[model samples]
Target: MSQNGLRFTLDVDGLTPAATAVARFTLYQNLSTPFLLTVDIASDRSGLTAVSFLEKNATLTLWQGNTPLRYLHGIITGMETGENNHWQMNYSLTISPPLWRCGLRQNFRIFQQQDIRAISTTLLTENGVTDWVPSFYEAHPPREFCVQYGETDLAFLTRLWAEEGIFFFDWFHPTGPDQKLVLCDDVAGVSTLGSLPFNPNTREVSTECISELHYRAQVRPSSVENQDYTFKTPGWPGYFSHHATNLNGQRTQYEIFDYPGRFKDEQHGQDFARYLAEGFRHDAETAACASNSPKLWPGKRFTLTGHPSLTLNREWQVTGSVLKGEQPQAQHGHRGEGTTLSNRLDVIPADRTWRSSPLP
Candidate 1:
């Protein structure tokens, strides 16, 4: 049986059964998906929440698993908030069996300033609580931050205000000690301030910086083997910028570079970091191909070949595969009689995607 389209719904209710207020809900899906989905919800004229307030839209695909499914596009839209001004989101999806399933999972949190009051209250309150208080004076505007987990390590960065709100700053690899710092002002813009050296013994970066807005510190490993680090910042109106580098010092083979919309001040810096990490994972996997590595399996004769066409043209190819000896077992397996072994050969493909392509 072919899977069908997805259906989503959200509900919001007040702490009191009948107490409700104007609440807005927006749902966004990364364009990286085979399809895009977005939903938005708002109040109605009668002040009564109705199902008609829900909006659903999707991007459909004509191709599904070799065969062109008659109707194979995805959708995006939003539903109304609950009666009591609470937020509830629901999504239902349908697609062909085996190839497509409802594999969607979402992580969301009520974002607020890291201030004592906001953190103490919002982080502690439940969905249907009326005891919630918004401390306007004590509220610190939300900053943007991002985190990335590579093969061998993790990195996080955040953009925040500094110097008593006179300057803006960035903190990267914010572990315990070995963190990188950057400061920016209207005159200087953004510039690298310094980096905290990694300490293997303590597994932390020992560094400290005190600015007017906040005090920051970080910790990280001295070195990482196979991993990637990502950096992202909320874009100004009509522009967004994100950068990622493999901990192994490799550049991402394929990526999309474009500006989204401006980010709201209330948006948490950490959320931006998380989004960059997620986007990098998707782009990297799509551009990655298997390669033979001597580091993974030593002392092996392997001829790494690029894409078939590249090999034919003597042009560098991005694809890689191992060459076996007369006896496959002799090349990468145990020598014992009837014993079979396979050695992992490592071969880093020569980057050539940009060699022949036009620069943007």
Candidate 2:
């Protein structure tokens, strides 16, 4: 009759401590995208009668026994109050990472002699983000010139990262109560979450197991080819292309071609072409699953076992997840065992190379 390990706590900055609990929550986390956490709160006091008095940021924490499962700290982008009856009032808030603030403003700026990493760092730091790490397996040469072109900071960063096969995810700080953004250009940068078992019996499995799963394979473009023009090499045609070798003869004749590859040299063009090709092949072989795991998120790898198919009983990395949890409405509240958690996860094989799709 107790949910001792399934308690969710929310603390708003500058808001006096009162009776507040997460009645329900939906958290969306994906690669190369900012995380969004929307929580329905039950509170005893309506001290935040008006949005004007609400704090700018808050910390949402989930606990399992004596250990904290996750600590999501973000800016309070939105708030809503509803159904104020008696002592308990219901409200909802939309929380997003500090990086989300970049999307609020547009700018026209030029970055000279800076690489993608440098430009990203400058923008992130300007937006008060100091806890970011970049993990690149290869080198990125400084671009002679780059223009923001009336785009928001988030859009600009997204374009640059997509072109360079870079992606980002947030990870909880080991020794702190916050999360740090990690940008990685290689799959090696992703951390592993050990392993979990797949149990089809949702009625009799632990909270950390996958309840249902599906494997997907589709025929996509087998190759990507693109051509770009450089003023320095006016007469020379700048063409580069790459083909996928992991398609296993599934419509290998299919090709993807494009113009204006946006590279300055042959090597750069080839790299971009490879990244584009990999992007198409990324979802060619994937696994979608439903789980009760609270720790699974993007940029992390986990091994799946107990599956009927031997091929699927391997390590996979999460690319996207939609996590939904609801606290039991029983009188026990925080100590109720009826609390439920469900998550839809999208993952790819651990050995496959992952790349962000190019933005239009």
Candidate 3:
């Protein structure tokens, strides 16, 4: 009959060492027209245990209003672990006497959830110009590390890296003979890495030798709203300071430094050290608001400070539905009740410091 669009963002952080996965299912319906059912299903996985070279499985179903239209079954494989892993499926069916006025529904199930230590957000650049990278560290050492960047999804990778105190190498396409490598240090020192001996036509690092040897420094994005904001460390080496704020000019989040190395699980010493170094003091008043709602205001502003590290893989999605009257439809062309599922996964090495500021 009719269809409506829906947008959703599901963020799951894994605290275990085993691999963990999540799924999302969607159903659609239109009450104004005759019976026409449509269904879409998707899945994703994230966490430390999700290796890049592994196969995974997913299940999906669909329903019209209340009656079953068709049943659909399928599997998803070749899932990689990191900041983002995803799968999707879609199908439609026609009921024997199309019913008018219907609705849709979806469900998701995780087959496993162990060894999935630490899951966070995946960031991407807005203009598709740059990429995010990640460095690994041990789960137990001390010294907090993190990253900060612009408002683009690309910033999420930096945030994750800042929290984890990891590093990432990003190879960019050489523009001209005057190609310059500008290394911006936490201090005010800016050094040039010089021009490439050979033209690197693509934005990829041609050789590990050349790329690894290039000038390396923590990369930070310039602030648009506050030009006075600096990307320098206060008293720490290889670290930077940053501030986060909300629309009301309230400082909701902030970061001090990023320590390089793994954490040591000695008598909660690592946790205490992290709490002292990479932690941010949330505004009690604002934090109370976040605890009360599932939705965030569109213009809310967040601050971050750190160096460039890894990038995350992310996607944009919207949901829709098809249905007849109040009956349910089936998925695909099968005669069973309809269902849907979606999942995502991220795997960080155990030897890394990934920490996040308090939410305000």
Candidate 4:
């Protein structure tokens, strides 16, 4: 529905973004780092101000009327040339989340009997994060752990939750006013787009809503079983090694890379093993689609009705989205309302809903 409903700004670089007639944008959330947004600009050079010199860490915000779709507090991660198609020069820019910028700060610390929740909160706070909450999922039975010397914020956070089968994701401030670094447990954000189970017995299904979808199933290799993984604290011999059974019925032994953090004991090793197995047991299903649904969003659940190959009525969660569009025709020297809305989405199988619902 973005035929005439998209506005954007990059105040960080003092950019006066007049209507560039030919353009496209891609907005991302939840699943990836730098929860990026891509801007594809195509126009005559005379009407275009050079945005290439925009500082690397400038903020970018996208708006639909007064409502903001993305508030990326990170930086301008990338800027490049796209194509000089049909006498038009195409250029692109990318914006990332704060997490990506966190890498510039590195630390070596120790935590003794600390709650993972509290640990994360303190780190987030020191990192300038405010306003946040969590769902009810315990990553491990043990409450404490320690990170080794010289670890980046992103690496530490990702590793800590990954061992517990939790994918740490950032959430946006829904109303577009409050600025906070929200870390979600497993889902996308504070939205109801696909936050529930696909109950086939009830609920009306929307048909032909998706214009394009690329779906795939993936399996982990049996070679992972060729090694054993371990985690240990000081004065301990390390927890039991995790074993993986190959398809031929023989257990393959492999090594889990050294963990920078210290685990309490063998019990924690068992938990880690379980996480590894769970990763192996599940066959990965991924979806990337293009749709015009402005309401379609990440971390929300919805159903599909008219696709031939895709499973009909199955619960799908948006892992991420790229809200993009451009003016169909070139407004060469002057600016006008030529921007439209086209969204690109990444989705997966969803199990449940979020704690705080989003505006429908």
Q: TM-scores of all models?
A: 0.18, 0.93, 0.19, 0.64
Candidate 4, residues 1-360: lDDT per residue as tens digits? 333456655434434344233355666665424466676665454333345434455545666677776565555666676555556666676766556655667889877677567777777677655555554344445455476468777667666656555544555565553444444545444355532222222214232156666787655433221123344434555544444443334334434443422345555656555455544533345677776565565545676554666464466777677766555444344365565566678776665322211001
lDDT of 3 by residue, 66-119 (tens): 433233221122233222223322212112110110111111212122111222
> Quick one: how many clashes does candidate 1 have?
54
What's the candidate order when arranged by decreasing lDDT? Answer: 2, 4, 1, 3
What is the C-alpha local distance difference test score of each model? 0.23, 0.81, 0.23, 0.54
In model 3, what lDDT does residue 99 have? 11
Please say which candidate is ahead in TM-score: 2 or 3: 2
Candidate that would win on lDDT: 2
Q: Find the 10 residues in a row with the least total lDDT in model 1.
A: 151-160
TM-score of structure candidate 4: 0.64
| Candidate 4 lDDT score at position 184 | 55
Candidate 1 regions with alpha-carbon error over 4 angstroms: 1-108, 114-238, 241-340, 345-360
| Positional deviation of residue 36's Cα in model 3 after best superposition, in angstroms | 26
Candidate 3 RMSD to the correct structure = 22.5
**Model 1 over residues 27-62: C-alpha lDDT tens digits?**
111110111222232222224433432222222212
| Model 1: per-residue Cα lDDT at residue 88 | 28
